[model samples]
Target: MFPKHVRTHHRLHHGHKPEELDFLIRRESVSGGATSSQMQREFGRLNEEEKENLLKGVGLRPGIPSGAGLLLKANLALSWNKLRHLRRWLRNWNVSLDSESKDREKAKGMTSPLVAEQLPFTFTVKGPDGKLATEVRLASCVCLEDISSTVLQRLDLLEREGKLTWHGVIPSDEIWLKIGGDKGGGSTKAVFELCNVAHPNSIENTIVWNIFQAPDRRHNIETAYKINLSQINALCGTMWK
Candidate 1:
């Protein structure tokens, strides 16, 4: 008799719990970012014969998300640790892009705005004077890449023009990307590593969710939206590699 249990699905799936059907559900969800009605069709695709094998616990898991994808989902989830990351993910969008045509001959061109609206993000960088600079507002759709380029360019131009020795998030020889929020001289926001804070629409989304909320007596944590920048003055001179 053929064995009831065979490690047949391992080639297709990994790290999945056999008993839990959430993997199946998530797999359907990821299939072209399936809609609710369409994904319901996956409920009982496993036939009786297939379920018999599954019952033998000889299969791997499915719907495993990448590390970055997991983090994005976790942070955006509604929880007490509600991090205000500002970006809309296409994964959660209602419609499927796959529904459109890839054939240039058959498909008509279309465009959609990255975000439905814009938000204002205010921040400050520290100058060599050991004091904080004035408020700099990124008053529209902005991302981490924009921040990196804009901050670097603005600082370089200022220094080149003898504006003032700015010693902020710009990494020096020793320190790299030292920036945080609540920069009225001291940082009260969490010290975000370069990798941690690197994201899209983070600047604007955070501001919209965290700062643009209805004014309330208990609505605090505006500092969570804060991005203060500072660095050791002498650890590494502006001599970058």
Candidate 2:
């Protein structure tokens, strides 16, 4: 089942099963023709603050209304087979615990001006022939040492040697990532706690791990894919309020 409000709205709007709702939510589909305004009306009793947090958790902004749509959309997006798994892995990725040895302000003066944001996450792309083209991973912990010469040197070594091992990922059956920190294998954490939610076990593990990085961007093609129209309509069902 989805969150309480989401489940209520699903029944009121579509008379659908949980799996069907799950499918529709990921696709961002609307059913039974509920408009965004309708959703707002349905959730009208919620306190303004609670509503706002709920919306943000699901990726909705303030004054956008569409409470129903927002809730469904967030659930769907977060549970998305590939994107959610990737996001969870990145969030759980542990940043190095070691404090910065040097000051960032001073280092800024010495180092070359930001060449580009250090790659946010790494992914592994495999071609039809099954040869690995690139290995990309996201980190859970973000700290000063991440960009240090030591880590860079390691990355360089991996690039030259072909196949780098990145670490600090949350451990979930769906969320598989290298465990530990640069100094040593760090502690292992679970994916459910990091995301604060869980999905049915029957769901297939159909997630891909890699894609090409567009210059100066934080997300890849897999992350940018859109949900279907039905979901958008359902989510929009409460937009007007």
Candidate 3:
């Protein structure tokens, strides 16, 4: 005999047997499309031990369709396989892109020219006492050694005319050209050719060379001699301040 509550809940209150009650519940779960929440509520009405015993006895549980669960699991596995394939493809694409970029750079380097196009600079000669001796414009491309010799020749011409006099060695081997500014980096080994130097602030694109002698003259004159070139543009003139 079925319990009164069971028969009432199953809508078989007209004194149905236990087998009829089970059949009604099974039919409600399978054919009526009962949800997981509804099944849980119905299952909760049974005692804990009874619920366990029933779960063991009935392999085909109620609520969710077995085929639906299997289908969902298969879909998830397929999605994971697609993701792994996409990741591998992206990695291969990146490697190919990097290889192409390196090849392009190598080709460019091979085709580049070696000679400097223009050599324009402004020169400032300072005496041992840190006084500005003269300022001249150089519009030719000459090596650092040639530039030093030119500066010495100019200074000699000035001395002969009684414009300036030096008590020490007339063309001191210590004389050297400092490129850029007063900031000293002993010597510049790199020689640039046919290069364009652009200074954002000024309109005059001229390299500044500060020619001076080192304070200590004991070192080898050849090794101590250093020359650097800086790109400092001349200031532009404007009427409107």
Candidate 4:
């Protein structure tokens, strides 16, 4: 016999299974009908009586106030085959993680910026020529991961003769970077810890080493910078309390 939970949710038999049929029927109801080929197949397997029950809205309330419909959809969303989205999630997604308000004027008048206003800071990467390979900066936040990608790109490591072998990142103690004067890559912190930078302003300007400068650690490319942090700036008026 199938596990108790599995038996409660699904059944393989073609005979009338009220629990299983109700699940698929209710999915289509809140979802405005089957949206995909797989869904259409599962829906077609339902008995005529089940279809009739859905048409009569047997287990649902009318339109927007349909509390039962909301609960059913929420349950289905957690299933292996996600049936429908929670109504509030759809609303937030359309906001673009920015803002809603179709009226531009209302958005403009609001104090909150659509996306976080990223503070700009710069990094100087030295090329193979030992000169400025590229200048990298984020429109806002700065962290170890961000710097790694930027450093690799700015140094043109992709086009370089050597591939970045994943020997493993060096211990944070061996590789050094500063957010500001004495504020970066603490003596005890590791690269994993450095990745969680609290603020962008922490790494405004730092000199990244050329491979030649650290020949022994060249193969371990990810952690070769000797960065220094002078001032650590957190978001104004937006910091979490």
Error of 1 at 174 (Å): 16
Which candidate has the highest lDDT of all? 3
Deviating ranges (above 4 Å) for candidate 4: 1-118, 122-126, 129-135, 141-241
Which portions of model 1 show Cα errors greater than 4 Å? 1-62, 73-180, 183-187, 190-231
TM-score of each: 0.19, 0.16, 0.15, 0.17
lDDT-wise, the better of 1 and 4 is 1
Winner on TM-score (3 vs 4)? 4
Taking all chains together, the TM-score of candidate 2 against the true structure is 0.16
Q: Against the true structure, candidate 3 has what lDDT?
A: 0.37
Residue 117, model 2: lDDT of: 27
RMSD of each: 20.4, 25.6, 28.5, 19.6
Worst 10 residues of 4 by lDDT: 228-237
Q: Name the top TM-score candidate.
A: 1
Task: Give each model's whole-structure lDDT.
Answer: 0.35, 0.35, 0.37, 0.34
12-83, model 4: which lDDT tens digit per residue? 324657886766555545445433665666668889877646645644422433233333433343431232
1-241 in candidate 3: lDDT tens per residue? Answer: 4433343354532466888766666645453434356668778999977886776577533333323322332344334345445435644433112232343455454232222222223345897899986443323221343333333444454446654422354343232222332324432222211111122123222222232322222222222233322121111121111
Better candidate by lDDT, 1 or 3 = 3
Task: Find the 10 residues in a row with the least total lDDT in model 3.
Answer: 232-241
Candidate 2, residue 240: the lDDT equals 18
